[model samples]
Target: MLKAVILIGGPQKGTRFRPLSFEVPKPLFPVAGVPMIQHHIEACAQVPGMQEILLIGFYQPDEPLTQFLEAAQQEFNLPVRYLQEFAPLGTGGGLYHFRDQILAGSPEAFFVLNADVCSDFPLSAMLEAHRRQRHPFLLLGTTANRTQSLNYGCIVENPQTHEVLHYVEKPSTFISDIINCGIYLFSPEALKPLRDVFQRNQQDGQLEDSPGLWPGAGTIRLEQDVFSALAGQGQIYVHLTDGIWSQIKSAGSALYASRLYLSRYQDTHPERLAKHTPGGPWIRGNVYIHPTAKVAPSAVLGPNVSIGKGVTVGEGVRLRESIVLHGATLQEHTCVLHSIVGWGSTVGRWARVEVPPVTLTPTIPEPAWTVRASSRTGSCCLLSPSWAAESGSLPRCSS
Candidate 1:
């Protein structure tokens, strides 16, 4: 049997995702048609002998988390459980804290994945590599450009042997183009290094002049403390992939990820794709429409669009590269592009919402007009280029 653990840091961690994080935890926020981490769970479930999936995080197990856990367990038919920490436990600390639970049933190895990454999780390949060498740590790595590589953990490995020779986390200087994808396969023996880190921290606290000033006992960063320190010891290895991968750090990136996943549906979930039936909505490319949604035949949607439950698309409406959330109505001829229409919101006929392409050029796209997407409870104002230019940000409308 095998297991998987997802390190989803709590609310405090995803501050970069603002209003959306306020609505739902960043990990639970919808990426394609489903919650973000569902992709991770689906990928894990596909692996043979995968028995259980544990979500280690600092969340309080609220209704959303609880409901998600239950739904995931049923959908995947696996024991998907959430392990909460009283406080923020560093990446390695949580693994060490729940070492026994993970090691239970004498499993061969377990996979640890970071919550915020979007990737074509190459789990089976990593498992094959692990079986060949039985290395304590196997990190999934991918190449990024030099400028972007500095933002991630860099790894240097032997060309033929694949042994991790050196490791650095977010170094100021460029070390290597290969960056950690925050996914790992570790054998049962991997817990020993975590225990060592814990013991060393405890000993340092006792020897310090101010014991209280020392780092907490349950604080172990897996990257800096273990991977960096253990490099060149013949324990850690890297498995490189040139597949689809990106970090979902902000809403814009989440949108980009949605596009990526939707594109993958052509092979993975073709039935989920919207088809141009004789009397249905006009479908363009890679679109997902919920069964409950009512879309007029004249409306044009796609090239990456998702219509959620009970959504109503009006006549001659144009929607592209955007998500029309549950119960939202795009009135006749209302054009929406690259924006999220919040849940239960109603867009007026002929209203248009178009967010400028995200870029670093010094120019901001000014909205030409404004549209009010009103929900039964409250209303969210989506402005055209004028107000958007003034605010210097895209506004998210929600109840």
Candidate 2:
């Protein structure tokens, strides 16, 4: 049997995804009509012989997360569990801390995924590669633009062998176009290196105070500590992919990822995309409207938009590349673009909410093709009662 482990960093990690993250855990936030990590769960469930999925993070098992787990367990029919770390254990530390549980049934191999990423999740290909030669670590690699590559864990590999020759995490200088996709397939033997890191940290703790004194000791950053330490040792390899992949670090990027996923639904979940009915909201491109939402026939929603539970779109309303969250009501002819309408928020008649679109650049959280937006995005956030007025000038907000 095989299993998968998702490293969902706690509340403290996704600071970039504010406001929305304030409402739901970043992983739980909706992307393409479903919670962000739901995509991950769906992808893992499709892999043959996948038995269990473990989510490792410091977030207390809150209601949303618990609900997601319960629902996912039923839907996937697998033991989907959450392993809460007592403290923030860097990416690798949680794996080491929960080593026993992971190795319990003696899984042939378990995949490790960073919760922030959005990808097509080519797991079976990695499995085939691992089976051909059981490498200790198999990292999914994808190419990024040369300038953007520096912001990620860069890898240089032997073309024929696919052996990771050198690894550097977020190097100041360019290393290679291929970067770690934050998705890894690790054989059971990979735990040995983690144990080694744990012991070394334990010994080093003796010199200081106690491992307990610091916030995290075994807090191994998988990129720097292990991949970098053992690259070219014949244990690490890369499986390059040209699949749909991006990181959801900010609201704008979330919007971007929604578009990507909505596009994918055409092939993988056509039913989720709303269709234009004889007397219903006219959908343009890819759109998802919850069954409970009420949209007027004259309203237009399209390209990339997700209307959540109980949302009411008034006549002539126009929504594009945005999410009308649960309970939000858009009065007659209101227009929302490149923005997210907060839950239960109301946009009065003729009001327009907008964010001037700009090319997304590589930055924090990760070099995600999307961006949290800089001052340009941060400056536009406006939630004033005055915004409801019928002003030709739109009220700007961060996407």
Candidate 3:
């Protein structure tokens, strides 16, 4: 039997993701109304050999990973387990730390993947190749057309044998466009390299060589140390794929990924706009507009706008690219482009909301505007391009 483990690397607060990851855990962030990690779990569970799944991560100790596992188990009806890491563990460190638990189960091969990613890559196909070749370790590689690949790591694989020849981590000089997809398949033997190194170096009294012996050693990054060292010996293999994949590591990437997933969703399941008069000008995509809501015929909504019960869009209002949680109202002739109008919050008539031109640059795209509220009426004022404290609660609207 084959089992898989997804590493939900703790709260990614240190990165530029900032405020977005502040409220909910990074893995739980919604991508097209579904948690980000769901994409990974759904893909992995469909694989033939995949039986059990373990989600490993360090999160708030109060609830820990239990919440995520419960939802996943109920939704997927699969045998799922959540193992909370006491401390932050690097990729390899997290695997090594959980080595004992994994060995206790004793499966044929285990799959590991990064949680902060979206991809349609055929995981089962890769597993099939691994089983056929009987390789102890396999790394998933995707075409690296972006420059960011240089910062992560680039893999050079023997085309004929499909074995990893060299791993150049954060190379300044360009070579292969095949970049590490932050996914891996490992047999029990993969742990030997790290365990053996630590055991040998510790026995030799070389404290420096065995970082695991130190207090905060669990943070020892795998890509920098373990994988880099193993690549020199050609112990790892690369499987390159040209499938749908995107890294959701930053705020900007998150928005892009959400749009990307929504676009793909449209291709498979085209949007069916409910023929309700109140649901005005609904774009034919995966959008959910409440029947009670009054959207003016002049207003526009779509690709991923979800309005809640009793929400209202005033006449001539233009709201695209946003989620109006519940009872939110866009006042008359207001232009709420690329922004979220919080629940029960009302954008004054003639108010304008476009991406902050200052934050805008010719080089990069703008972040999606998000407004979230519960019970308080929205501040009746014209919102600027960028407002610092944009979220609040409002009372439930009567009409």
Candidate 4:
């Protein structure tokens, strides 16, 4: 049997995805017409012998998350569960803390995925590689440009053997072009190193009493403490993939990741992609519209657009490269381009919600347009044109 663990950090994390994270947890945020982690669950479920999937995070099992778990269990026919941490535990800490739960079924190996990433999840490929070598650690790696690589965990691997020779997490200087994709396949023996890190942290915590120190005794950074330490020991290996992969660090990246997944729908879930039909909304490319969404026939949505549940698209509205969230309304002739329309938000007639469209590239600095919902009312109204160019900050919405 095999299992999968998804590490979805708590509210304290994903600070970069503000306003949206304010309305819904980052993991629960919709991407490609479903909660972000649903894609992870779907991918995990497809792997043969996959018994169960566990989600480890510090969120208090709120209503939305609870519903998602229940729905996933029903849909996947597997025991999809959420293991909440007492406090904020580091990536490795959660795995170590819940070791027994993961190892209970004697899984041959379990896939560990960071919930913040979007990928075509080459789980089966990694599993095949793991079965061949039986390595303790198998990391999913992908190439990045030199300048963008510094932001991720870089890996140095033997070209011939594919063994990880050195590892660095977000180093000050460029280390390697191959960056860790935050997707890992590990055998049961992998828990030993995590335990070692936990015990060492406990010992160090006892010796030093610095209140300012972060990542207390229980916190274990999987990248720094495990991958970096185990490199060159013949225990860690890399499985390079030239597939759809991107880190959903900010809302801008979320939009970019949405486009990636929407494009992927053609291969994985073609039925999910909207088809241009007689008297139906004119869809240019890959578009996912919920069944309940009421879209006008003249509304043109395409190329990469996700219309969520109960959304209303008015006549002649043009939506491209955007996500119109649940219950959002685009009034007649409104144009939404390269933006995210918040839940229950309304863009009045003839409004243009857009930003200067940057050519989508594999790099991380692309501009983003966001329509932030009102924290007080849970909705906003865009009466006039709104533009956002920066990826790091949320734009002010006119209520």
Candidate 5:
């Protein structure tokens, strides 16, 4: 049997996801009409021999998270549990901290995934590679342009043998085009190295004159402390994929990831896509509408739109390339494009909520106009380009 662990960083970690993370934990934030990490659970459940799944994070197991876990367990028929960390543990720390729980069932191998990434999750392919060599570490990697590669953990692999010769975490200089996807498959033997890192940190902690200055001995960065250390030691290998993959680090990236997943729904979850019934809203392309959402027939939504539960779309409303979150109401004739409608907020009649479309490419920086919701009011105000130019930064709006 196999298991999967999803590392969702705690509250202090996803500050980039401000207001949204304030309402819901980053892992529970909706993407493509579902909580972001649900995609990870669904993908893991599909893998053969997959036995259980665990979520390791520092967030309190609140009601929303608890409900999600129960639903996932029922839907997937697998034990889905959350393992909370009392303190912030780096990527590898949680794995080592919960080593006994993870190894209890003697899983053949377990998959470790980061919560902030979106991908097709080529787990089976990675499993095949692992079975062939039974390497201690199998990292999923994909190509990025030379410059963008510097933003991620870069891997230097022996092309013919696929052995990772060297690894660098967001190096200052150009390293390699192949970047780590934050997805890994590891044999049980992998924990040994983590134990070593733990022991080393403990030893180093004792020598520190001021222990408070240390990040804590429990912190273990999987990339720097493991992959980078084990490269070329005949323990780490890389599996390259040309599939759809992107990191959801900011609001713009989340919007782009929504589009990517919406497109994938055609093959993966067609029923989730909204359809044009006789009197239903006119959906132009891939769209997801929760059953509880009330959209008027004249409203037009499409080409990558997700309407969450309790949302109300009025007649003649135009929504495209956006997400309308739960409990939001778009009044009649309101035009929303390239933005996110915050939960429990209402757009006035005929209001136009928009921002220039952002096209994500390695060469272009993410657009500055992606409006983030306010944690206090669950609403956002968009600033004009001129105001942004004058201020040299986007204005933070509330209510």
Candidate 6:
């Protein structure tokens, strides 16, 4: 029997996300009507022999994750366990920290994945590859593209054995087309190295030194540090996959993944995107506008938009290439494109929230701007209606 564990890198509320991260933890954000991490969980659950799923992260350790788990259970119907890391552990560290819980089945092999990846790789095939090689571990590999894999690490494998030869960090040059896909199947022995690292850290009174601890306090970035170090020691393997794969890292990446997810869903469930608005809004192909949502008569929605349940779209509103989370309100005459609106958030009336408006209609525009708040609470926002002649700074709103 084989089991799997998923390590959702904790609350993404750092400087990188800023204002957007303030309203909700990054993992909780909607990636095509579903939470980003939940997508990984649902995908993992589909893999043969994945009986249980575990989410480890450094959050309040209770509230937020619990709520997410409840919603996940309701949506996915898979049993999930939320493990709170008292200490922030890196990827490898977090797994090792919860080793006992993960290895409960004492299975021959287990699966592990990064929370931020969106892929259609066949997990069962990877498992078969692991069994065929009879190696200690198997790392999923994707064909590298110019845009990606430059910043990501490479998977150097023995061409004949398919065993991971070495794991190298972003080398700044075109190294290999096979890049680490942030997914893996590990034999029991593969975890031995992690155990050794943990013991080493315990002796030094440092969880990071332990190598199996969380990120902030632990030296646990698998690609940046752990896997690279382990590769030098020679115990890892790689399994190449021929499938769609993308890293949902930054805001830009998030938007791209959302569109991709919608497109994929439309492939299997076309009716899910069907809206009976008659002549209300201009919903584009593959958009998901929830039935519980109320779109005003004078609004224009979609090209790729996901309006969550109970969301209220005001009259004269124009939303394209955006996601409106559950219970959020879009005031009258607002134009929101290329952005994500959090749950229960209220956009002021006649506001313009986009990267930036352009002088031409069909030309490329700018990066969407948000209120810059120095504190954790978030920054003050402003709304500029398209009908208005001028833009003005608006008041600050709390999450």
lDDT by residue (tens digit), candidate 6, 137-222: 67888776655556678877778766565677787876677788788888877777777666665566763334534323344566
lDDT of 1: 0.83
Rank order by lDDT, top first? Answer: 4, 5, 2, 1, 6, 3
Encode model 1's per-residue lDDT on 178-199: one tens digit a residue. Answer: 9999999999999999999989
Q: Given candidate 3, what's the lDDT at residue 247?
A: 75
| lDDT of candidates 1 onward, in order | 0.83, 0.84, 0.65, 0.87, 0.86, 0.68
Q: Comparing 2 and 6 by lDDT, which wins?
A: 2
The alpha-carbon lDDT assigned to residue 168 of candidate 4 equals 100
Clashing pairs in 5: none
Which digits, one per residue and each the tens of the lDDT, describe model 5 over residues 1-399? 999999998989976566667778989989999999999999999999999999999999999999999999999999999999978888999999999999997999999999999999999999999998899999999998888898999999999989999999999999999999999999999999999998998987733365555477788889999999999999999999999998887666778889999999999999999888898799899999999999999999988999999999999989999888899888777778877777787876656666677675432566656333232334445555444323322333323
Give the per-residue Cα lDDT of candidate 1 at 324. 76
Candidate 1, superposed: residue stretches over 4 Å from native: 206-215, 358-399
Give residue 35's error in model 5 in angstroms.
0.5
Candidate 4 stretches with Cα past 4 Å from truth are 206-208, 368-399
Better of 3 and 5 by TM-score: 5
Each model's RMSD to truth, in Å? 5.2, 5.6, 5.8, 4.6, 4.8, 6.8
- Candidate 1 has what TM-score? 0.88
Q: For residues 21-77, write the lDDT of model 3, one tens digit per residue.
A: 655677876665567788778877777766788888777634524677787888777
Cα TM-score of candidate 3 = 0.77
Candidate 2: C-alpha lDDT: 0.84
By TM-score, is 1 or 4 better? 4
TM-score of every candidate: 0.88, 0.89, 0.77, 0.92, 0.92, 0.79
